[model samples]
Target: MPGEAPYLAVADVLRARILAGEWGVGERLPSRARLAEEYGVGRNVVQRAVDRLIIDGHLEGRAGSGTYVRSPRERLRLVRSRHRERPAGFPLRPGTRERGRADAWDAHSQVRVSAPAEIAGRLDISPGDLCVTTHYEFLAAGQPVQLSASWEPMALTDGTPIVLPEQGPLAGKGVVERMRSIGVVVETVVEVPRPARATHAQANLLGIGAGDLVLLIERTIYDTRGRPVETADMVIPDRHREVVYEFGVDLP
Candidate 1:
C-alpha cells in the first residue's frame, strides 16, 4: 500500500518468509545490515522489524549472537469449572491443577483503597468507596501465566480478621472461605470472558507482543443474599494458555 511505513512493509515480508519456512526453526536470520541492504531500508528499519517479530514470538534474540526463529510452544489448558472446590485452601474457580501441576501465585493487597468507577460498578458500590484491592500474578513452571486485580468492599469485612485477604489467619484462603469466616455465605459467581489485545505493560509481564490476543475475564462473587462480595478482572495470554469452561450436568 502506498504511504505504508517502511518498517511495517519490511516486517510483512520477513513474516511471510518465516511462515514459508525460508528460515527453519532455530536457524539464524541474516544480519540486520544484510536485511537492510536487501530491503533498501536503513538498519534501524530492519532492527524494528526484527524486534517486532521477537515480540510476536516468531523469533528469539541471543546475546553475542544473531536472531533465530523460535519454536512453537504448547499452550497450557486453564479450566474454569463451576464444580471446583473454593474452600479455605483450594483455588477459586480456575484451579491451578487444571494447568497441570501445582502452580505458584503471589498477591499484594492494599487496605482502604478507593474503588475506581468500573470496579465500583461491578461491586454495586459507589465510586470512590473504600475497598481492599489485591493484585495477583500466577505462575506455571516459573513463567507468568495469568494476572488479576481484585476488589472487595471494605464495609463487608471492616474490623474483621478477613479484612486483609492475604493477611490474618485466613491468609491465602480463597474468597469463599474468607467471607464464610466473617458470616458471609457466598452463593454464586458470575464471570464474563472476552477477547482483548495486550497493552504494552501486560505484554511485558506476559512476555508476548503488545498487540497479541489475551482473554479478559470479569468476575464477581455474590453472597447468599445476592450482595456483591468480591470482583476481579483476570488477564490470560492467548499465546500461553487455552481457557476451557466446564459445568456439571444434573440428572432429573
Candidate 2:
C-alpha cells in the first residue's frame, strides 16, 4: 500500500505539472531512474506514475521514443449542434436540397462482418449475427467528415426485399418510418454517446486512418411496446461533424 501510495502521489504531482504547463506538449518526462531520485521513490513507483499519466492522456509513449506529454489538440472537445430538423433529407453539402438516395447506401466497402459486442448487446442480438452493414463516409472539401454504419437484424432483414445496397438511403428513413410502412410503429428512441476506436473494417469503411479519433453515437429504435427494433451506430470524425441539442422549457 505504501508503494502504491507513492505512485499515486507521484502521478498526482506529474498530472499537476502537466496541467500547469511544466511539461509542454510532446516533451519527454524524466527517465525512470531520474524520476525516482527526483521524487525520492523507487523506479517501479516512478514507472507506475508514468503509466497512470499515459492512461489519463496526459502522457504518451512512443515505441522507439520516451514518454512525453500529449498534445493539447489530441484532447477532443465535442461540440453538439443546436439544429433539429428532419433526419435524412439534408443534402451532402450545406444549403442544398439534393436528395440522398438509397443508392448511396450501397456497399462501397465491408467494414465489419460480425456484429460487435456493444452493438449486439444494444440490439438484444447475438454477435456475428447475419447483418448487412454499410459504411457511409460524408466528405466536405475532400476530407472525411462523418462515418456511420446501419445494421439490420438478419431475421428481420435477411432475405427481405430491403437488403439490397440500392436500399441504402431508405435505412435512414428512421426505422420507425420504415417499420410504419410495414405496420410496425416504433415507440422509443434511445441514443447513447461514448468514445471508441474504429475496428479494422470500420477504418476501411470510413477511409480514416487507424486509431483515429471518433465519436460513437449509438441509437436504438424500439416498438410501441418497448421491443427493440433497429440499432444504428454513427461515427463522427472529430473535425468533421457537429452535435446539436435543443431544449424546450415550460414557462413559469
Candidate 3:
C-alpha cells in the first residue's frame, strides 16, 4: 500500500509466512540480519517486524536465544449474561463455567480511599468522596485470565457489616447481595465494553505482551432507588478469552 511504513510492509510479509506455516511452532525464526538481507531491508526494520509479531502473540523472544514461533493459544469463552443467579443468602462462587472448574480469584481491598473524578462520576459521588476499592484477579487453572477494579461509596456501607467488600460476613458476595444485606436493593447493572491495547502494567498482570488487544468493560450497578451502588472496570485479554454478551427478549 502507498505510504505504508517499510517496517509494516516487512511485518506483513513475515506474518504471512508464519500463518502459512513456513516456521513451525517453537521453531526459531531466522536472525534479524538474515531476514533483513533476504527482504532487502535494514536490520532495524526486521527487528521492528519481529517485535510486532511478538506483540501479536505470533512469536516469543528468549533472553539469550532468538525469536521463535509461539504455540497456539486456546481462547476461553467469557459470557456476560443478564440471567445471573441472585441467591439471597448464598455468596456467588468465584469463577465461571466457561473458565473451567476449580477456577479461583483473589482480591485486595483498600478502605477509605478517595474516589477519582472518573470513578466518582460513574458512582454518582463527589470527586473526593471516601470509597472502598477492591482489585480482583481471576485465574483459571492457576493462570490469570481476567482482572477487575471495583469501587463503592463508603457512605452507603460505612458502619455496616459489609463495609469491607472482601471481608466481614458478606465477604465474596457480589455487590447486589452485599447491598441487599444492608437493606439496599440493587435493580440494574449497566456495562459498556470497549476494545483497547494492553498497557505495560496491565500486560504484566495478565502475562501478555504490551500492545496486545484487550476488552475493557465499564460497569455500574444501580439500586432500586436509582442510586449508584457500585462500579467496576473489568479487563479481559483478547488472546485468552472471547467475550459473549447475551440478552433476553420479552414478549408483550
Candidate 4:
C-alpha cells in the first residue's frame, strides 16, 4: 500500500525513535498523552501504535508502568556438525565432540518402559516393546538451556552394564559409546529441526514465557547396519539460543 494507516504511520516514527536510541532499552516511553500531542495524533492512536510495537517484540509493557524498549536477548549458539557424536577413541576421530560439554547435565533413566507406537516406529520395534527412557536437563552457566528425552530398546541392552543411560560405569556416556561397549558400532546420527511454541510444561522447565519460540530437535542414532538404536527429542529455547550447523569442505 502506498500509504499506511494513521496508527501505523505513527508507529513507524515511534519505532524509528526507539531504534535511534531516543528511549533506550528498559527506559520507559513518554506518556501516551505526551506522545499524542507531539505526534499530533489522538491518544487512542498513540496507544494503538505502542500496542503494535509491543506485539512486534520491540517493546514490552509492565504493570502500572509505561511501555519500554525491550532489552535485546542474549542468545547462545548450539552447534550441530555434519558429523558429530562419534564415540571417543574412535580412530581418526576429531576433538571432543558431544553434547553439554560447555555446561552441566542431569539425566535420569527409567527401565522396562514400554515404547509408544510413535517411538516404536522410529526405533523399528513393536509397539509396547520394552525400552529404557531417559530424561535430560542441561544447564549452561547454571541456568536451564536444553531438555531431552531419549529412548533405547531394552532388547539391545537389557542386561548390559550400560543398560541404564545415566547409571553405571558408562553412565552419562552417550548412546554411541555405550553401544560401542556392547559391540554395536554407531555410524550415523540424523536430526530433524522444527520451530515450536513452548508448552506450559516446557515453559516452566526452561523458565520462559508460555508460547515463546523454541527449537524442537528430533534426533535418531543409527548403527552401521542402518538400525536405529536410540532416539531423542531435544528442546532449546529460541529466545535464549540459536542453532548453528557446520559442515567440512574437502578438496577434490
Candidate 5:
C-alpha cells in the first residue's frame, strides 16, 4: 500500500535486515540517529520503527541501553487435565505425570472478602457474598511462571480447618484435597482459556514487557451437586510456557 505510514516501511526494512542476519543475535542495532541518517528519515521515524519491532518480538529494548535482536525464548509445556490432580509425588502412587521443574509457589489468603460480580456469577452465588480469597505466584526452575487468584465461599468453610486454602493441617495441599478434607467432594473442574495483554503488575512479575501476550484461564471447581466450591483466574506468560490438554479415551 503506497499510503502506508513511513515508519511501517522503515520497520519492514529493519525487520528484513534482522531476519537476514545483518544484525547478529543479541547485537545492538545502530543508534536511532544513525539509522535515520542511513535511511534518509527522521530519528523519530526510526524510533517508531524500532518500537514496532519490539512489539512484534523481533527486538528488545533495555532501559538505559540500546535495542537488540530478541533471542529465542526457552519455552516449556504445562499440561493440565480434566481428570483428578494428585500431588506431584503421586507418581509412585499412580497418577499422571507432573509438570514444571522444581515447582514452587508463594501465596497469601484473606478471610471475609466480598465476591466481585464476575466471580460471584462463576460461583453461582449472589454478588457481594462473603468469601475467602487467596493470591498465588508460582515459580518453576527459580523463575516466575504463573499467577492466580482464588475465591471460595465462606459459607462452606467458615468454621472448618480448611477454611484457609493454604493453612492448618492440609496446608500446601491443592483445592481438591482441602475440600475433600471438609467432606466436600470436588467432582468437576471447568477451565476457560483466552489470550490477553500483560498488565503492568503481571509484566513486572513475569519479567516481560507490558502489553505482551499471555494466556488467561478462568477455572471453577464444583461439588457433586453442581455447587461451586471455588473459582480462580490463572495467568500464564506465553513466552515461558505452552498449555497442553490431554484426555483419556472413553471405552464405553
Candidate 6:
C-alpha cells in the first residue's frame, strides 16, 4: 500500500527538490499535465503528487490561479509576549477551557509526553526534565485552524490545582495570572518567532506533512527580578492563523 503508486514516487521526488532548494519558496511548480508528460505518467498521477504537496505545506493553491511554493517571511521584530486581546464578538465560549476539559484537547491527542533535545535547551532544564506538555488544535467550521503547545515545569505544576484545564484561563487568565497569585510577579515577557518546518511528530499531530512551513513561537515569562519562570513553545499552522500584535508605543 505504501509507495506502490507511481504518483508516490513523483511526490518523493518533488519533496527532495523542495528541500534541495530546486524549487525555492514562492516558486511555481510545473503544471500537472506538463509534469505527467515529463514523468512518463498519466495526468492523474501527477495531480495526486501535487495534492500531496499542498497538504504538506510545500505548495499553495489560489482559486483560478496556479499553485505556488510557500515563502515564509522573516521575524518582523522583537515581539513582547502579551495576552492577545480577543476581538469583540470573537468566539469565547469554546475557548481552551471548554475544549480541554471536555477531552476535546486531550493529552492523548494534543500533548506530547516526551521532551526532545531542542525543547530541553529552550527550557534551560536538564535533558528529560519533567515537562507537562499540553497541545491545542483549534478548528474553525470543521477545518484545522491552529496548533499550539504549552509546557510547564513538572515541579511547578505537579499535583497543583493549576494543573487542571479549567484553572488555566480564569479571571486574569493565562500563566501570568496563576503565577501572580502564587506571589510570582512577572515583570517581563519575551517572545521570539521563527519560520520552521514541522517535525515528523508535529506533522502527525497537526495532520500536516513534514517540511511544511509553520510558525514557531517561544515565550518566556520572567519574574520581577528578571528570572525566567516558565517557557511555552507554540507551533502554529500558518494556514489558519494570521499573527498580529496591537500595542501603544510612546514616540519621541
How well does each candidate superpose onto the true structure, as a TM-score?
Answer: 0.79, 0.58, 0.91, 0.75, 0.86, 0.54
lDDT of 4 at 113: 95
> What is the descending TM-score order?
3, 5, 1, 4, 2, 6
For model 3, give the 10-residue run with minimal summed lDDT: 93-102
User: Which lDDT tens digits does candidate 5 get at residues 17-62?
Assistant: 9999999889999999999998888888889899888866789998
Q: Which predicted model would earn the best lDDT?
A: 3
Model 6 per-residue lDDT tens digits across residues 1-252? 144788889988888888899987888888888888888888888888887878666777777777788775322221222434656875433222222111133232222255567766766667777776666665544544456676666655566555533345442256777777667788887778898887888777666666667888887777787766667777765544545543455699
Query: Which residue segments of model 3 deviate by more than 4 Å?
Result: 1-3, 86-102
- What lDDT tens digits, residue by residue, belong to model 1 across residues 56-112? 788988999999999988877788888755568765444545644328888899999
Leading candidate by TM-score: 3
Instruction: Report the C-alpha displacement of residue 3, candidate 2, in angstroms.
Output: 4.3
The per-model lDDT (C-alpha) reads: 0.88, 0.64, 0.89, 0.85, 0.87, 0.64
- State the TM-score for model 5: 0.86
TM match of model 6 to true structure: 0.54
Instruction: For model 3, state the Cα shift of residue 219 in Å.
Output: 0.7
Model 4: colliding residue pairs = none
Candidate 4 to truth, TM: 0.75
Question: Where does candidate 5 have its weakest 10-residue lDDT segment?
Answer: 89-98
Candidate 2, residue 79: Cα displacement in angstroms equals 6.5
User: In order, what is each prediction's RMSD in angstroms?
Assistant: 4.6, 7.3, 4.0, 5.3, 3.7, 10.7
**What lDDT is reached at residue 41 by model 5?**
85
Superposed Cα deviation of residue 175, candidate 2 (Å): 3.5
Give lDDT tens digits, candidate 3, residues 25-49.
Answer: 9999999999989988889888998
Cα-based lDDT at residue 173, candidate 4: 80
> Runs in model 5 with CA error above 4 Å?
5-13, 34-46, 83-99
